[model samples]
Target chain A: MSKKVVVIYSGGMDSFTVLHKAMQQGLTPYALTFDYGQRHIKEIEVAREVCEELGVHHKVIDISAINQLIGGSSLTDSSIDVAQGHYQQESMKSTVVPNRNMILLSLAIGYAVSLGAEQVYYGAHSGDHEIYPDCRPIFVEKMNDVAAVANYEKVEIFSPYLNNNKSGILKDGLAMGLDYSKTWTCYNGREKACGKCGSCVERLEAFAANGLKDPIAYEDT
Target chain B: MSKKVVVIYSGGMDSFTVLHKAMQQGLTPYALTFDYGQRHIKEIEVAREVCEELGVHHKVIDISAINQLIGGSSLTDSSIDVAQGHYQQESMKSTVVPNRNMILLSLAIGYAVSLGAEQVYYGAHSGDHEIYPDCRPIFVEKMNDVAAVANYEKVEIFSPYLNNNKSGILKDGLAMGLDYSKTWTCYNGREKACGKCGSCVERLEAFAANGLKDPIAYEDT
Candidate 1:
């Protein structure tokens, strides 16, 4: 029997890869996307398309209240501009939504436990650990302990890319025959991705390092 | 200068006491209420009344989607009957919403971080430790560790009644000269509370043990 797992699908490349990887491992995946009023609301549409193509159950939870509850993050606040350059740049810190992963993972665990699923998956890579505190190894371990006590089922959290970078995730996605065109990673949320933003730059670099062209169109690419 | 604290107000006797306790400590309190699909949804209105009387800011978050995600809980599922008798009875286990406190506290932390609140308060008493795992001290410690890593501001979660029972909580509230008449604690939402349900039974016992009459009217009282 295939193990049931809930995938935190954000319609981003990393999450796209996580979904495909879970499928490759013979796990029944439930894609959970949070509509948290992000600048890139278009990612939710892309998530729907990805789930449809993969024949998986998709759940889009409305947590838009988070945008009102948390302010400072460029992703949710229009006053702060999305920075261009690499993920390691100091300005990229504005894009960090405090406790974003913690809140998402907490809800995902509740959904997973309700469904009797044993595992919850998210694509928190080593790259995110630099800017996003909740993406770090210690956060994952501590959150898992919280999950253990929070539910009777003891659902475990799985982050396959925790030790890997975006490039490694891209390589794995390519091996799983995932079509990267369906994914969206631009922070600017334009008709065509503003390929100069930190998210776009990192994604473009990962594709370039893999000796392949990114499938999505970009304003600058 | 008083430190601001966000109190998780459910309009129950316990949470009502928590709000009064925070006020007695001279802390600025913000009440957060979750409008989850609960049988006792009328408690939300009671929460609003309590907040208005206390003159504290109240935030009502819509999280009814949890009812769709988690179905086994009698509190959220209409098909399941609200079990009657003592809270420690085996049938009362059905009232447990998996990870209820964790999900609520996660959002409360986000709200606290947004407002620069240094502490978040909830009324999880020792009486709840038996049926609710999330109410235990170990869970509280682990969740605080997660909160520390999850946010840059590091909002601490405080449970004033963590070591006390329902009777103790009532005693403290009485000492504070709080008007318990506004609080609501009924598993079955109706014109008058069904006094036979586990929640009503426990609450009545607490008031009786404290030599005080519960202010709210009950069908069988």
Candidate 2:
């Protein structure tokens, strides 16, 4: 039996790799993007484009009301600076969005149940564990239990990229022969990838570790 | 020191009772409501008024985007029938709202943590457990684990009415001298409470079992 999976496609390299790997593994990928009142609307724009490019059924859900209701996140607040530098090095307080993964995954789970999809996929990586507690395995387990009891729909939450590093994801994308050029990773709202931003730094480092040149253009290399 | 607690206040009979009880128990009741794109905006109106009546700091967050993203609940959907009947006799399908309490509680946990409030109060009685899986102790236990692991905070998710029947809530509310006249419970968008709605039926039954009359007008009875 063929299984349909919904990947929380964020137009980032990590999610891009997950989507590509899903297709290679003979699974039909239904991509979901969130317009969660992020300062970087460019991410949404990029996510929409990638879904179209990949010819996958995609959904963009609005959860900005959550930001309006629950503020103080650097990602959601204009006054707060998006933390730059290594993800592990950045203080938890600087980048933490407070239950962001929990909310996003919950929305994904709801959509998956509606679509009758077998699984919900997210691109939570190992490197984010120190800062974002919701990105950890424990959160995934606890929320899966909550999702199960709440929906009562025998559903499973998948975080395939949770234990993986940037190099591993980059390698997986390369192994799947994915065109990673279409992906965007910069958190800043700039034309070119600001190499200074943590996202760009991770992407560049991953590609470099894999001995491949990243196709995305950088502004401050 | 007055212990701070966040009450999931909907200005409805049960939530209002819970908020009043929380305050009566010597805790500072912080009223929190969600504008989740429900058809009956009147409930929100009642919620605001009830908060004012209690003289507590009230906040209504716009989770409308989340609702719009989800879209298939009887409470939120105009297309669906607000199934009216006895709570225990209703079809299980009628009870499920796709992880609502879990989602709401999770959001509350986030907000509570931000405010440094360690307790979150929601009113879910035994009569509700007949249809709502979220009203069960199992879900609450799992959610507590999620809150702990996600935020590393000692946030407690409390459903004071969990083991209590409707009659029990009525008793508690009456003991606390809750202003039932100010509380709204009808799902129908009408001036008087629509006794046909499951909520109204439960309310009526609770008051009847408690040997008291519900202090609200009903269109049906």
Candidate 3:
């Protein structure tokens, strides 16, 4: 294989676009998914299917241990209910997983360096900057500096969507002929997407703004 | 319970000293151990025992998935032979787990924020700076900055022994009257300490330089 890059492919809409974009750029991308014991673990299944279709090597790392260690977040804690609404609403902040991108990026850096990959790709869009501190521009910039000195190879983080919102990411996927139905965005782990959840709301609004209906089935679509 | 500090306890002499020292400072320390598929996994059992003795909460997190992800290091990869010599020797660099401290510190920060702890304690001594990049002062300083931006509570990393060497750590352990026999440091995991590996050599030399015999049984002590 040519020089490769590690992608934090979470089997979500944003990450699906990232994996396809990496391939279109002629980079050998390895998909890295995490089983962090989130309510929506079904995303791992979607991630595996996408990797199989793309014919890329995928590593589904069990980071459930970290989730078990830090139990306050609503996404991982059973006691806290996942709030549902438009993502920009303040109540949607309950779905924020603390330091999630940092933990994922750290592991991706280690994996990329170990495999001699030059870069790590994670899909942290401008949409997440409002609630998740780890997804903000400052955190990404600081983490890049930390990763530079953390390893001998100094594998860097490449988040192309840091300035792009959900609609921009959806447009990229539509251009790449991605079957977005295979991607998941529901915080509620059910057979059909809970259209009211913050994640589903953002994803639906993005598709609508892109002049396309979301491919996935929604409870009230 | 008052404010607590999370300790990255590895059931090794240096971390054993950190646990005791944190207690002496009147900080309730919660021990966090990661079973990252190290050759000496028995050390985790030792960690549990020590935490029980200290009457503190112990969290043994299974992060072996990370070891499986990054496979080059000898400590986690069984295919690689652990080199035997003084730790300062160039050959000992094979044992350096890339970004090991950063990964651990990241998890500790998450756990600290979850528990609302003010600080995270790790036992990184001066002796490791020559071989491990992650154990260097620069890496620690950068990671602390990253942690500050990564979380809401901003739990800081407190590495008290960053300037202390093996003998200096051993002296602190002795002052605390810790039973060093419970700790394990041999890189080559076995019923008896492999007295020739880099880890064993540094540990034995530390005890000797401190004018005390190591309490653990060795192959040729």
Query: Which runs in model 3 stand beyond 4 Å of their true positions?
Result: none
> Model 3: which residue pairs collide?
none
Model no. 1, DockQ:
0.66
Better of 1 and 2 by TM-score: 1
Give the poorly placed runs of model 2, Cα more than 4 Å off: A90-92, B90-92
Off by over 4 Å in 1: none
Over B1-221, each residue of candidate 3 has an lDDT whose tens digit, in order, gives 56699999998889999998999899999899988888877788889988898799999988888986788778888899989899899888788776787788888888888788989999998998888888878888888888888866687888899999989998987888878998988877788988999989999889989888898998865
Interface RMSD of 3: 1.1
lDDT of 2 by residue, A4-75 (tens): 898989888888888877777788888988887777877778889988877898888877777754688777
Q: Score the docking of each candidate (DockQ).
A: 0.66, 0.64, 0.73
Give the C-alpha miss distance for residue B128 in model 2, angstroms.
Answer: 1.6
Residue B13 lDDT (model 3): 88
Q: Give the range of the ten consecutive residues with the poorest summed lDDT in model 1 chain B.
A: B62-71
Candidate number with greatest DockQ: 3
- What's the C-alpha lDDT at position A96 in model 2? 72
Q: For model 2, how does the per-residue alpha-carbon lDDT over B1-221 read when each residue is reduced to its tens digit?
A: 79889899987888888998898889998899988777778888988987786689888987776654467778887888778787767553664666677678877877787777998999987777758887888878888888888875668889988899878888988987676888888878689988877778888888999898888888756
lDDT digits (tens) for residues A63-144 of candidate 3: 8878767777778888898888887788776776767777888888888888889899989899888788888888888898
- The deviation in Å at residue B102 for candidate 1 is 0.9
